[model samples]
Target: MAEDHPRLAEAQREHWQSTYGTHPGMYGAEPSDPAVHAAGVFRTAGATQVLELGAGHGRDALYFARRGFTVRATDFSPAGLEQLRAAARRQGVAARITTTEHDVRTPLPLPDASVDAVFAHMLLCMALSTAEIRSAVAEVRRVLRPGGTFVYTVRHTGDAHYGAGVAHGDDIYEHGGFAVHFFPRHLVDLLAEGWRLDEVHAFEEGALPRRLWRVTQTSPGGLGGS
Candidate 1:
C-alpha cells in the first residue's frame, strides 16, 4: 500500500512551496523556539556525520553545516530541496551539505551504519497514520550506526488547542482545513528497532500554543533489531 495520503501530501507540498520555498532563510532565521532549542541539542551532541530527514528549507541542515558537521539533508519535495540548495550556496556552505530528494516511507538512500546522528523535526506528525510513522522510524533506524543518536520532535496528542471542529480519536484528528494524526505512545515506543532511549522531554510551543515532545536515543548495535 502507498504510505502517504495523497491529499495531505499535496497540501504539504503546495503549502511549503508557497510559504517556505520563496523564503528559504526564514526557516532558520526565525525558527520556532522548540526547533531552535532542538538544534542546540544536536550541536552539543558533537556528531561529525549527520542526516536530517524531512529537511524542509534546510535550515537545520545549514545550521549543522555551519557548526562543522558534514550534513546530508533529504525531503520528498523537490522545490524544498532546491531552496535548501540555494540557501546552502548563499551561506557558502554548499560544499559541506548534500541535499537529496527522498520519501521517508521508503528505504533511505544511505548505507547501513553510515551516519553519526539523525534529526527529524515536525516530520512524524504529518504521516497521517501510525503505519507510515512506523515505516519512517524503521528507515531512521536503518541508516544510523551503533550508538548514533536519533533526535526528533512531534506534536503532542494531548494538545487542547486544536482548531475549531477538530475531532480526535486514538492517534488521529480531523480538524479545520486538514487532518493530523499523532503517535499516542510515550517516547519509548518510537525508538528505532535496536535503539535505547536516552531522554524524553515535552515542551509547549508558545506560538502554536501546542504541546511538543522530543526524544533522543542511541542505536544499540550495527543494525535495527526486530
Candidate 2:
C-alpha cells in the first residue's frame, strides 16, 4: 500500500517539520528514560562518543554531552535541530555536541566504525518501510566500532494505535497527522540477526502511554576486536 502512496515519507517529513515549528521544544528539557538507561550502558561499555539518530530537540543529545560523551545528533527536521543547538548552547555543552539535519532513510554521514555507541529513541518506528528500517540498522552496524552498543526504541504491534488510523501497509498507520510503523516481534529479531541482542524491555511513554520496546544490541566481535 505504501507503493500506492510514494510520497508518504516526504509527507511525514513535512508534517514533523511543521509540528516542531508549531510546538518548539515540545518534549521538554528532560532526557527520556531510555536515554538515561543508555548512558549507564555506554559508560559500562567504555564508550566515549555517541551517535544519536532522530534526536528531536536534543534532550537526549544534551544528556549524553552532560555525561561527558562527545555526541553527534541527527534528525530530519531542521527546526528541531535548531532548537537542539540552542539548548546545547544555553546548557554550555555546545562544544561537546553537533547537530545534523538528516533522514534515516539515507546512509549515515559518518565513516565505518566511527562511533563507540549509538542511541535512537523511537526512530525505527517512524514512517519508514520495513526494508528501509533494516537498511538503517545496517548503516548503524557499519558506523559502529567493534563491540559498540546500539540502543533503540520502537512502538510495537502491541500499541493501542497499531490498527487505528489510515492503513499505509507494512504496518504503517497515520493518525493525528503522525505516521508510525508499528514493529512486529519478528522484525526485531530479524534486525538483530548479525548483532548480539542484549535485551528487549517493554515500556510506556506520554499521556497516551505509547507502548514501546527498548532493544539493546552489540555489534559483532568483542570490544575493539573486530
Candidate 3:
C-alpha cells in the first residue's frame, strides 16, 4: 500500500532506519507523558488492551504493558519494530506486547472491535495526507470496541518548523530528512467523523518547544465511530 504513494513509501524505510541507527534507544527509555496519562484514563474506563500505531522503540508500548494493558505495537520501520521486540523481551513483557511492521495509510490487520483503545503519538502527522489520515482514523475506529478511546498527537500548524522546510502538499513539509504534515485544529474536526472529539489541547516539548495537538476521542456506543 505504501508503494502506491511515493511520499508514503519514501518516508517508510531508509530514512527512518538511518535515524534509528544513528543512536541506540533513540527516543530514550521514558514513556511520553501523554502515554502515561492515557494509561490512567484507560484504567478508569476498564480498558485493558490497546493498539498503538507507530510504536517506535517500544518506550510507550512497554509503559502500557507495565501498566497491565496488552498492546499491539506497530510501526512502518522493520528496524523500529525489531527494536521494540528486543525491548519487550528484555523487559519480560514480550507476552503483553506484540510487534508488527505496519503502515497506517492502509487498513489495520486487527479484527473489527478487537481492542479497547487505539493510540498514536506523532504517527498521524508523519507525511500522511488528509485523505490518508481520514482512512487511518477510520481503521482505528474499526478495530476499537464500542465506546473505545482513540488518542493521537500531531504537530500543530503553529510549530516553529511548520513552514521552514520544502513544501510538499497541503501543510506537509520536508526538513532534516523527514516529512511532517502539520495539522490545524480545524482540519481535525473536518477529517474526523464518526467519533466525538473530547479534547484538543496544546502541549510543547523538546528544546525547540515542538508545538503539538494532543487529541482524544471516543467512539459511539453502538457500532463505534472515529
Candidate 4:
C-alpha cells in the first residue's frame, strides 16, 4: 500500500484549512452554482448512496444530501472534515451525512460493492504519483457496486494557464512556489483500469485558460477487466 507523504499531507492540511475551510467560496474560481449541475446529474441518474473521496468542506456532499441522497464524505485531513461537519450543520443536513477521516493512499474503510456512487473533485491531481492515483481509483472501484458510477474532475495536461512552459517530466510540475506532481492521462487510460468512461467534458477556468475535465465512470466486469 502507498503511504501518505508526511510533508505533503501536512502542507495540504494547513493550506486547505487556511483557504477552502475558512472561506470556501474563494478557494476556486467557480461558484456554488456549478454544484447545481452536479446535483442535477446525480438526481437524474437516481444515485442515493454516495461516497465522496477527498471531500473537502463537504460542498458536494451537502449539495447531494439536500437533493435527497445519503452521503458519506471522507478526507485525510481532520481540519477539512471539521469544516464539512460544520457546513452540514449550518445547512441543516447534518443528519444526512456521515463524515470519516480517510487517507486515500491506502485501502478505504468500506465494504465491497456497497456504494452506489463515488464523487471526487480536484483529487486526482493532488496525488504525488501515478501509482498512488491508480491505487485510490482501485479503492474507489472496490467500494462501489458493479455498474456504480464515479463522478470526478481533473486538471488536464499542458494547459496554457497552469502547464504552459512548465516541464512536467513523468508527473512533476513546479511553478509559483508550489511544486505539484500531475498525472495527466487520456480518457481511455482511465478506462483501462476497469472503469467504463461515460463522459469527458473539458473547459477552461476563467481567463487563465486553466483546463478542467469532468469524467464519469462505471465499474467493470472483473478485477482487471472492464
Give, for candidate 3, the lowest lDDT window spanning 10 residues. 1-10
| Worst 10-residue lDDT window, candidate 4 | 25-34
Top candidate when judged by lDDT against the true structure: 2
Question: lDDT of each prediction vs. the true structure?
Answer: 0.70, 0.94, 0.84, 0.69
User: Per-candidate TM vs. native?
Assistant: 0.81, 0.98, 0.93, 0.80
| Model 1 lDDT per residue over 3-36, tens place | 3366565665576566565665555544455445
lDDT per residue for candidate 4 within 77-109, as digits (tens), equals 677788778878878999999999987777999
Sort order, lDDT high to low: 2, 3, 1, 4
TM-score of 3: 0.93
lDDT of 3 at 205: 78
What C-alpha lDDT, on a 0 to 100 scale, does residue 123 get in candidate 4?
A: 76
How much lDDT does candidate 3 score? 0.84
lDDT of 3 by residue, 114-221 (tens): 999888999999888788888899888888898888888999899999998777767888888788889988888965677888888789978998999888888888
Q: Candidate 4, clashing residue pairs?
A: none
Report how far residue 143 has shifted in candidate 3, in Å.
0.7
**Which ranges of candidate 2 are over 4 A from the true structure?**
none
lDDT tens digits by residue: candidate 2, 138-207: 9999999999999999999999999998999999999999989999999999999999999999999988
Per-residue lDDT value at 194 in model 3: 72
C-alpha lDDT of candidate 2 relative to the true structure: 0.94
